[model samples]
Target chain A: MATNQQRDTNLSPDEARALRFDVEEFNTEYARILDAQDIDAWPDFFTTDGFYRITGRENYDAGLTIGLVWCDGRPMMQDRAAAVKTTMVHAPRYLRHYNSNVRVTGVDGDGTIHSESNYLVVETLMEEETRIFQAGLYIDQFVREDGGMLLKSRDCIYDSLLIPNDMVYPV
Target chain B: MPDTPFIDDGSNLPLSELRWPDDDLTRIPDWIYTSDEVFQRERERIFFGESWCFVALEAEIPDPGSFKRSYVGDVPVIVSRDQDGEVHVFENRCAHRGVEFCRDLRGKAENFTCPYHQWMYDLSGKLMAVPFRRGDRGEGGMPKDFKLEDHNPKKLNVTIRHGVVFASFSETVESLEDYLGPDNLEQFDVVFKGRKLKILGFYKNRLQGNWKLYHENLKDPYHATLLHVYLATFRLMVAGQKSAMICDESGRHSTMASAKDDDIEITEETASQMKSAFREGMELSDPEFLNYVQEFDSPWTVTMQIIWPNLIVQRELNTLGIRHIVPRGPNALDMYWTMFGYDDDTPEMDKHRLKQANLMGPSGYLGVDDNEAIKFLQDGFKHSQDGEGIVKLEPEKEGSTQTLISEASVRALYRHYREVMDI
Candidate 1:
């Protein structure tokens, strides 16, 4: 019965603007790494105890815990990265990740930044036409690390009712 | 249902025209995967025929007046709990003009009204009111013999066993208990043993392959230790483990049961047989999620059951779910997955289930491979000439077998499929 709770942010306009820019930069690098299929480097974007999950909006709205992909910690995420890179079998494909409308929602007392963004992933198989694979929202929490931001938690809530086939790469 | 005929040539390519590629169940014809005529007959002889199809779990619509849109073999239907708390299943198609009225996937509705003409129906699908029954102050009214009871949406016979709901178009179809047969019923009860279930979530995806291929996939355990490298590498379900390809009396139903024998090392001979699947040194960074608590009263750690025409009961270690296969056409199917857990599970147990969830769904470590492999099977037929696919493993046996390297259950399935489909 996990749920995304609403939070009220009371950030100064200048502070909010600066934090939003940093989040946008973080997402840019994150998407670049994924789109390039550098799956091994995917875990570097997260904290040591980072949480990651990709669940359908229907499940999210219903407050259900089951996820298409759920990683409790950075170790689990690294395990997933390894599996996708070597063990898991799938078709050879190219993916493009587009993240936009980044919104810095709140800054926690522990310096954790709550944010959300719209994401769309388009995929192309060998000799097949490209298609919209997923359209979703990334509800995230970021922690400042080494003067940059690292994702402490990311819950990708996809809006597509039916995934065309398999989501080979992480969103 | 709009019966828009795809081929005007006839009513189900005469049984004589469609033949099995071999006398025994060694080879499967390519046309069976690519022919539209066979698809039409499946609709008539299998789906709408005398078979109990899984519609929705009672947990989905737990409250009175709650309804969830589901399908019984590609035919859209609404599974509703009436105000009296009785469950009902009826076609989503409006009795008035054939418009699929139940658009929402799930909700609590006192009654349903067709948007096309505002033809209202109660939660039990009894036609409550017709928009112009008396016709605008009696000006252009009906002939007055239009009975609400007679014009209700087609209803299906529903039977529930331990909160698992099944609906059937055939009134004379055997009870769900008998239909599942004794062996399949025993495997089924291991999961649905009268415990209250909490629905975890859902995953819907379309597989670009025939629906039957999915049944074949689970029944054919020969591919499990090979295609799914993660399973083989992690010692989850490798060869030489205590496994069985079990089929019910009807052969259409089967359970691929296997116990995790992690203490036993894979022999060098088996390792060579596994080839690339047996990764030499790969390991999981967090192996705690692979924990298997002895929750069920069964010996097997995995029990993947294909319940006849539509349902797949998956109980792989701690992860539990049911996959409903909705055949769209000969080449594709829509799989609706509903993951669940016992209501009495602890918070830690819940977290463990989610962690293990990565092994199943569309992006699962194991499930993704099966989806891709089935797609490859369909693609091969689409691109090549009419040829037969071989299913000769454990060729001597035709029903159940005790070894992992046998396709006996798959052959058993085709044996029953041929009889039911009359191909």
Candidate 2:
């Protein structure tokens, strides 16, 4: 009889380890995509029906508030990417994200892998020197899919209480 | 040192002539934003004067002896429930030396003890105990004539309606109903509904802009569709919806409401095109996006209530929220947004709310854009001697119902603002 873990269709242990590496690669690629200002490629990392939200830990822990950016489906995410890229006018700056310490926290009975990682983003603006923009941990949930893994949800909990400047793009 | 040429005092500069055209408010006097004197006067006349500020909801302090501490303008206040089940609000300062009496954000406390001298006050704002009061030898302690009754913190006028709590510094301020106005009162009823509330969470962010700018942002509906395109792309709000900008008789409170499209007819050709281009009809990985269950009594998809001075109650689709503005300085304001769902919401609905919660908060796709925009406005004002941004979007109309792309409500806000400031 296939046990719950065996019955599940997640990648094998070795494959899962490799999948983690794949996720790291994906995270780096995602950051690069944002840095490149190629918003169209940003939404491609998630599943079609994935969830993406940017919320402060204060609201998240209190369970009393919503986030600034909430995208439940891929279309919504795509729509946000399109809108911010084309319509919004913001001060020009360059953001460099460093995502590390990727660890899979748990694997649910349904083969959903819960993971977390620490990240720091440094932003340099025109006529200003580089500064630490934000540092936080990314709490994410992933599901196995054909050919690769798909992100089901991503929650970024920033450690920096004060945001130096406005958050215009995805972290 | 004899007859110095008579220099003219600037008082004759014709201040009214300096005012921008009655229809336009874009070129506001630099004195409005940068004057320390004006800010101090505003603090006295508005924040500490006649205005009903929303303090806390009944749900926050439910049981007797439960208490929550918040600020009314800049004054720290304690909202507590007494043994008799009545709620009372008092300044959170010890009357003796004006030390902060309550330190906890929220808790069940029988009485608040001042750490400075150990003076105690009950939840009812009555002096309860004072340490070493009766001198052992009847010599050294609180003055023999010191009376406990005289040391109670100042109590403000308070009123509760539909589970929301409001307090005012001025005794002569209008009643809650009068303050909320008729149109906004009806909208409040729709969201609050007298039901027991469940607090979902709280989000806090500091906007580097004047507090007035935040109020104007909420009142100005023109930016909604353009700034928050997530609303349009997801069909949460469309350009063609029937929308209204409503204000109270006093013009202090405002409501921006819009109904979603119930009769959206999609032609087969368009449907096919949308499906192919964006995969519109595909099932969301999380089904919550497709869930638009109307739990509130209102027909509108979103109702953003801008209570005068510094409170906003937002009922957006499934997410219910309250935003409180705390001003740190003339240029910086802290925003505390609390999102909520009713206690009776089912697990599915709760999940739906949590999923939809992405629409608000500091990181919210819509909210972040607003924060960025507010900062941009502040930054723009810093370099320019002109302190005010033009808000003359729709000049012809008054008393709400302007075009979707106009700043009429912002004008209304400033109109009431000038009344309070008496500028």
Candidate 3:
């Protein structure tokens, strides 16, 4: 027996409109935190067991298990934030994320929502020109928590073959 | 009696503007890492000469039409399995105008047509047809007797061993076995194991340094003990362990292997007291990543093998991978890492590999540091009037040695590099 996920189509126009507004607000906050390099507060954006990964679309479509940064749970992400900040010393840079073309693709019977949006991150070092750091799609799964949208999973599927110098920040 | 077998004696100098530092393999002239003259010569002699460059794995293209984009030096090539289940690798250039025909990194394609002139070629790179061959009005096409058989993209001699693919530009290049030698072959086959491979993912990045620096890094196990803290922080590798740094007769290919001591238990107290890269009170929240499931019978839990100029086969406690190096210029090079696991891996085993993958890649605890060290070397020598690097650790011994605290393998790399480069 097939689940009704494919053919539900039961989202009313008004409900879909409201969900889109909430998703837009959620993404705005997401970009603000990342661009500000508020890495310490990253955990608050996700659930206790959220999954975050940054990989190439090639690997994502092939269902490969590896990523540039593969965080299976909240602890892994927390560890990364802690280690890179305290232990690792690398050239500092600034990043700004521009997310657009957002689309809320689906909503489960539960409060879970599926979404995708086009994203391009610009990276600027001390003296270098602001270059296109990474361009990709954000494949996301979100749910309501404390009356605000919280990410359950965020798969950053980048398009380029080569990552410049260092992907220091979470793109 | 002179203690050092080779030394910078500073005598009888026939310095024709580009001589290396004395006769010692340890003292490398800064010029080799900085000269445009040397970089140009290397492209032809080292890359196109009698060297078997790692192109792709047999498992990368699993189906008849499957393909992967790869590099042989700076030249782009398409590694595709043809309809009859035979693997063929050909230059991505179109014979018509020398333009790159295969644009996408990879995909299934029956035939490719040049976008410039629409000259069609089959999967085997044979020229099949040209659009408007006789012209729309039978007036402006090729000559009446033009032969379509004359044109094809350059094809290379490909050798597939244990699911690893090596290609050579020279048709007369020795067999893969002859090139790798018995010692290197045994080490190379240890990881390949004739088991089916499943490509897990890739991590691609560039280093702001010479491409050969990447090769030397793998050959020099001296740095692994000093540079990477995560190795010892997790008790994966500790100095003075049972290890071997083995090289082939040519000294171009080498393997640095270190066996794990399963009996040792790592704690904050034991770590801080040790003089190694171990840190006190620095333990992983998820220690499961450090577990080395003895999937192989080799004494070593970690083995980093360098197959001459292009490839690195790594088995760091069951997290297997092959990193391909593409030289962009004298100052920069791109690295493409293909991480994999056995096709028959259990879910538990797969997670183990993925968790440990944090040990490598761009943000990898150990991997990024390797990139930084090489970049520092390149920058450190950019404007130096006279500078040379000392690889004289465990001096006088240039071939395979048992000690982990040795730069003997770095000497091995330069020995073969000089012979091929005739510098």
The candidate maximizing lDDT is: 1
Question: What interface RMSD do all candidates show, one decimal each?
Answer: 3.0, 7.1, 6.5
Give Cα distance to truth, residue B320, candidate 2, Å: 2.3
What is the per-residue lDDT of model 1 for residues B1-423, given as tens digits with 9 covering 90 to 100?
Answer: 222334222323554676676576888877787778788889988999999999999999999999999998889999999989999999999998899999999989999999988999999999999877888875996677878889999999999999999999999999888898899899999899878999999999999888999999998888999999999888889988899878887789999999998886889999999999889778889979789999888889999999989999999989999999999988889999999998999999999999998999899999899999999987776655546789889878988899999988888888888888877
- Predicted structure 3, TM vs. truth: 0.89
Off by over 4 Å in 3: A1-21, A36-38, A86-89, A146-148, B1-16, B134-138, B262-277
Question: In angstroms, how far off is B293's CA in candidate 3?
Answer: 1.6
Task: State in Å the error of residue A157, model 2.
Answer: 3.4
Docking class of 1: medium
Candidate 1 deviant stretches above 4 angstroms: A1-7, B1-16
- The per-model lDDT (C-alpha) reads 0.89, 0.72, 0.80
TM-score of 2: 0.78
Error of 3 at A82 (Å): 3.2
lDDT per residue (tens digit) for residues A1-171 in model 1: 223455698999898899889989999999999989999999989999999999999999888888999998999999999999888899999999999988888998999999888999999989788889999999999998998789999999999979987877788
Off by more than 4 A, model 2: A1-55, A58-90, A98-118, A121-135, A140-154, A159-166, B1-27, B96-98, B114-117, B133-140, B231-240, B262-291, B296-299, B386-389
**Candidate 3 residue A33 C-alpha distance from true site, Å:** 4.2
Docking class of 2: acceptable
lDDT of 1 at B125: 91
